[model samples]
Structure formats: structure tokens, C-alpha cells
Target: MIDAHIHLDQYDQTGIKEMINKWSENGIAGVVAVSTNLKSSYDILKLKQEYPNFIRAAIGHHPEEPPPNTRDLYELIDLVHQERKQLAGIGEIGLPTYKKEELYTKYSEEQFIDVLETFLRVAKKENLPVSLHAVHEEAKKALISLKKLKVELAHFHWLKASASTVNEIVSSGYFVSVTPEVCYRERDQLLVKQIPLEQLLIETDGPWQHGGPFSERQTTPLLLKEITTCLANILHIRYNELLEIICHNTKQLW
Candidate 1:
């Protein structure tokens, strides 16, 4: 019951202990806590120190925003080297999809590609899995770089790609995750059907909102139960069966 991807640092700081306790009580084991920027990377790493068993940190610049400055990017790489043991992966990195046009106003698409390449190399150097944010056409673009760099362990978190692209990703032996959106979103359900049992992971991407059944609810790892139930139904398996398989899939990647 690990949440394969989440912006944990984005959650509220107050009463964090109570929140973790509740999640633990409900069978939520831990999370792959991803970073969105240099500061966020540090925050997640620090949180890992406090809750070593619960937080598997993945630090990197998120792609939908402007690229990191040279000094910050170098520092991030350095931080990764220093804390490689604590990291679950290099993550939340990819080319922008929703923000592509807006980001292009500030920096060229090539700049974003270059940044993603650098982070990919970092992940490769550390021999760590990556949690990617690339979706739509950008997912394919990220896949090209991963293949070029020969990164073997990757999780396309909350992936939104065509059927053909998903097949290619699955064939590459990388993992893909579904968020709680799978409970109500047909698109996510269809995405799950394309993924094999061994490569399927579940996440909440907590602190981010969802519509339908999850509307107005605070996103958290506990939502994994609902996601697991939905996944079980979609995959036509029993609840515990899907749980064990997903847990195994998560470990296989992270």
C-alpha cells in the first residue's frame, strides 16, 4: 500500500503526525514523496529524516514550470549525490504538456528537453528509478530520452498517453501508476486495462484535488483503498489479490 507518487511536501505542516498515524492505522504504508523544485527537494529530504520508514524521497524539478537556474540545478545534483541513500528516485521530471505553450513564452522547449536530459542522467548515475510527469505527446518524448540513456527503472506516474505509447512503455519494462482518479475516470480505467498486473502501481498524488467520487475530499494515501478497490474491479480480481499484486509491482519499481 505504498503511494507510488505524491507531492508530500505540499501538504500542510501542522498536525502532520496525526495524519500519518491515521494513514498507518488504515493500512497505508508509505509514499514516494516527489519534489517540484530545489526547495521542495530539500523539504522532502528533511521530512524523510523525520519519518524514515514512511518517506521515500525523490527530488527534482517539475517540468510544467520554468526550468531551474544553473546554480540551483547543480546544487540539486550535488544534493542527490550527498543523499543518494535516502532517495527513492529522481523524479517528477519530464517535458511539459499542459504548460508547454505558456512555458515557451519564457524558455524554449529545447531548454526543457535539456533539463530533463540532465535529470535523466542523474537518475542513471545513481542507478535509481525515476517518477516521470510527462503525459500526452510529451510522454513519448520522455520515453525517447529514457531509451537513449538506457534507464531501466522508471515509473510514469499518473500517465496519460495513447494506447500505442502505453504498450511501448510496458514493453520497455518500466512501471506505470494509476491515481485515485481511476475510481471515476474512464480514461484512467482504460489506462489500467492496458497495464499488466506486474507493472501496475497505485498512487494518490495527494494534496492535489480530484473530481467525481474524490471531489471535496482531501487527497491522502488512505485513498489508496478506494483506488485498490476500483483497480480490482477493473482488472476483474478480488480486493486482496489486486492489493498484493500492486504492492509487488510497487516494490519491483521502487
Candidate 2:
């Protein structure tokens, strides 16, 4: 199975090395390591090099925190271009929603859009897929920008939007990923029923904990085994069947 989104750079190097060693044994084929800043982008690239066959690198700046000075943001864009061949895509980038008011007051909405647009433009020019973080109304705004830029390969990671917005994203032929929350949340299960298997992907959003049995546990891709089982049960399909399809979807994206 492929873990389509994870922040491997956020983990300790020793832990990551151990994780890599067990990739084959754990039934993990590949992982898309996404970055949240320029430094993280560099770290992801290095990890990809360290485990070329198991990790795909996606470099970008996340939107939740106050963004770096505009100059630094563009420098990361330049980094994307410079390392295009070694990179899998541009991602973990989008407008903020959960922290919207605070971020908007800090960076201003226009400034945030400017940063998002720069990444979108770079993604378009590079012909790379983008892993997005927009939710609610911000998801709508992101769709507009993607349509405006004519970006075909986009992944909306851990997305939560209205039915109409989801239809728009599906019809546009973009991808949306679900997390382990689908194992427990009604909202996420509803999304599984609504989206087609071809357009759907599975992720752990690991290193970021969730509730229930996962509350006190350390997040890891190994948890995907249970997630896949739960998703297959929800979709009323066999486990291996769903696993194959999810892996295919990941390959199609990156």
C-alpha cells in the first residue's frame, strides 16, 4: 500500500531509518513525504535520496502559520524548480481555514493567496501534482485558482467540503484523500460512500494523532492496515481489492 501523504521530516532520523528498513515487511510500497517549509522541503528531498525506492518528495510551505517573508516563499518556489526532477510534486500547500481568522489577521488574505498562487503557478509550469490543504470555503477558493491555472493533477488532502464542492472536485478529475478518521467518523465515511474508488486515496496524516484507539498511540503508516480494512468494510469490498485500487490511485497521482 502507498501512504499518499506524511511528514517524514517531522520524525526523528533514527525512527525514520527504522521505518524505512521495515517498508517491505510492513507491506508499505511507497510514501509521499510532504513538507511544510523550506527547511522541511530540503529534509524531504534528502530522505527521498536516502530511500529512493520508498519515498516520493513533495516540497511546499504550509498555510496555517504566518508565512515566511514573501522573498523566502519565492525562494522555496525556486527550490521546487531547481529540484524538479528529484521531486514527486508540490504540496501541503493551500489557503487556511481552521486557523483562518488568526492567519488572515496576521498575513492578510491577499498575502496568503499570493503565496498559494506562486506554488500553483510553479506546479502548472512543472507539470507536477499538488497535495492541498484547503477546507470549507477555502476549498472553493482553491478550486477556482486551480481551474484558473488549469492544473490537472491536484490532491486535496484531508478535505472537508460541501456536496456541491465535492462534485466540482470530482468532475474536475482531481483527487481527494481520506485519513484513519474514516474508520470512526461519520462525516469521513460519508465521503467514502460519495467518492468513486478511482478518485479516492488513503493516507495516515501521520505524526498527527487522532482520537479513539489512536489517541495515545504514536502515528505510523503501519496503522494503514487497519484503516484499509475499515474502508473496505465500509465500501463492502474485499480488503485486497481495496488495497490494490488505493495503490493504483496513489501511482496515478505521483
Candidate 3:
């Protein structure tokens, strides 16, 4: 199994080795270590070099942060282009949801749109899949931009969209990934039920924190077993069947 989205760069050297051992023990085949900035992109690439078989890099600037300077953005694009073949995709990119209150004031929504457009264009040009972060209304707008740019192979990670919007995303053939929240969050559980099997993928979204029973648990790929089990129950499929579909979906993305 593959963790379709995670910020592996956030983990330290010791944590990385521990994660690798856990993945091996848990039967996780690989992870898409998505990035949030130029430095993160570079770090994930280096990690990929060390564990080529277990890690795949997804390079992009996260929208929640202030937009990068022109020079920094240019450098990031150049680096991503140079390492395109080594990447699983361009991602951890999208418009900020209203929940990111500081971002709305610190970085204008217009500025956020511009940055997202740049990433969308880059993803389109490179013919790589994207791991998106847009949620709620932001998810709707990101979908619009993707369609406008004719960007294919998009995975909206931990997506929170209206039922109609989810239907639209699935109809358009884009993928949506669920996180551990699906085990307890009603919205995430509904999302799993609503999305088609072929379009469904699972992620940990680690090392981001979460609530519910997982409140005190360490967020790691090892938890995917429980997540997939929850999803299997929701989708009325066996654990192995759902896992096979999700694994195939991740392969289709790359």
C-alpha cells in the first residue's frame, strides 16, 4: 500500500528511519512525500535519493504560507523541472480555505489565486499529477482552475467539498484521497461512500494532527491499516478488495 500524501520532510533523520521500518512492518509499499515549499521540495528529493524504492516526491509550494518571492518561485520551478522525472507529481498546492484566517489577510486571495494558477500551469506543462490542498469553497475554485488549465491527474488530498462538487470532481475523472479522519469524521465517511472506488485513495496527511480517538496517537503510515479498514466498512467492501483498488488508483496517478 502507498500513502498517497504525507509531509515526510517534516520528520527528522531518526524519525525517517523509524518510519521506514514501520512501513516495512506494516506492509506499506511506498509514500508520496508531498512538499510545501522550495526547501521542502529539495528535502523530499534528497529523501527520494536515499530511499528510491520507498519514497516518491511531489514538489510544490503550499498556499497557506505567504507566497514566495519571484526569485524563489522561479528557482523552485526550475528545480522541479530539472527533477521532473524523479518526482511522483507536483503538489501539496492549492488555494487556502477560509480556515487559514491569517493567510487571507497576510496574503490576498488574489495573490493566492495567482500562485495556484502558476502551480496548475506548471503541473499541466509537466504532465504530472498534482496533490491538492484546497478545501470547501476553495476546493470548488481549484477545480475550476484545473478545468480551465485542462490539468489532468489531480488528487485532492483530504478533500472537503459539497456533494455536488465531489460528484463533479469524480465525473471529471480527478481523484480524491481520504485521511484518518474517515474513521470518525462523518463528513470524511460520507466522502468515502460518495466517491467511486476507482477515484478513491487513502492518506495519513501526516504529520498533521487530528482529533477523535486518534487525538493522542502518532500520525504515521502504520495507521493506514485501520483507516483502510474503516473505509472498507463504509464502502461495503472487503479490506483486501478496497486496498487493491486504492493501490491501483495510486499507481494510476503516477
Give the top-scoring candidate (lDDT): 1
Kindly list the per-residue Cα lDDT of model 3 for residues 1-254, writing each as its tens digit: 99999999887777688769878787999999999998888889999999998988899999878888889889988987899889889988998775479876666888888888898888888888999998898889998999999998899999999999998899999999999999999989888878889998899999888789899998888888989999888878999988999999998896
How many residue pairs clash (N, CA or C atoms closer than 3 angstroms) in each of the candidate models, in the order given? 0, 0, 0
- Residue 241, model 2: lDDT of 93
TM-score of 1: 0.98
- Better model by lDDT: candidate 1 vs candidate 2: 1
Question: Between which residue pairs do clashes occur in model 3?
Answer: none
**lDDT per residue as tens, model 1, 41-76:** 999999999999988889999999899999999999
lDDT agreement with native, every candidate: 0.91, 0.88, 0.88
lDDT of 3 at 128: 88
Quick one: how many clashes does candidate 1 have?
Answer: 0
lDDT of 2 by residue, 1-254 (tens): 98989989887787777777776688888899999988888889998888898988999999886777877787898898889989999978999888888877767888888888889999999999999999889999999999988999999999899999998998999899999899889999997787888999988888899787778877888888888998989999999999999899999888
- How high is the lDDT of residue 203 in model 1? 91
